[model samples]
Target: MPNIPRNALRSLTLLVIWEMWKERNARVFRQYGRPATEIVDSIKGEALLWIKAGDTALANLLVRE
Candidate 1:
């Protein structure tokens, strides 16, 4: 929680929740599941998409120091 903007934090929280939900559904319905590392990678990839879509607050929060 590195002093991220509220919007950025909200976006991240929702992203995590959505991903977890999808994983749960996949496991329960499709008998498929991904490792936690893969889930984190998916989140990173999706964050890049958000950045491309002009979410500067998210971009700032994600940037390496």
Candidate 2:
């Protein structure tokens, strides 16, 4: 989160929490399981998707410096 703004941090936190919760429910209800690295990658992918969908400037900051 270094060099990222506070709002980005908050959004990232919520995204991560929601992803983890959803994965947890899947594991419990669907007997699904995945590696931790895969989950982390999914969370990163989701954050990128949401950022691109919501804020182009932020998306650029994330990807293009």
- lDDT (Cα, tens digit) per residue for candidate 1, span 1-65: 66668887888888889889988999999999999999999988888898899988878888844
Roughly what TM-score does model 2 have, to 2 decimal places?
Answer: 0.75
Best by lDDT: 1
**Per-residue lDDT of model 2, residues 1-65, tens digit only:** 57777766677678889999999999999999889999999988887888868855456557745
Give the TM-score (vs. native) of candidate 1.
Answer: 0.86
The residue ranges of model 1 lying beyond 4 angstroms of the native Cα positions read: none
Count of clashes in candidate 1? 0
Candidate 2 off by > 4 Å: 1-4, 56-65
Cα displacement (angstroms), candidate 1, residue 37, comes to 0.7
What TM-score goes with each of the models?
0.86, 0.75
What is the RMSD of candidate 1? 1.5
Show the colliding residue pairs in model 1. none
Task: Give me the candidate number with maximum TM-score.
Answer: 1
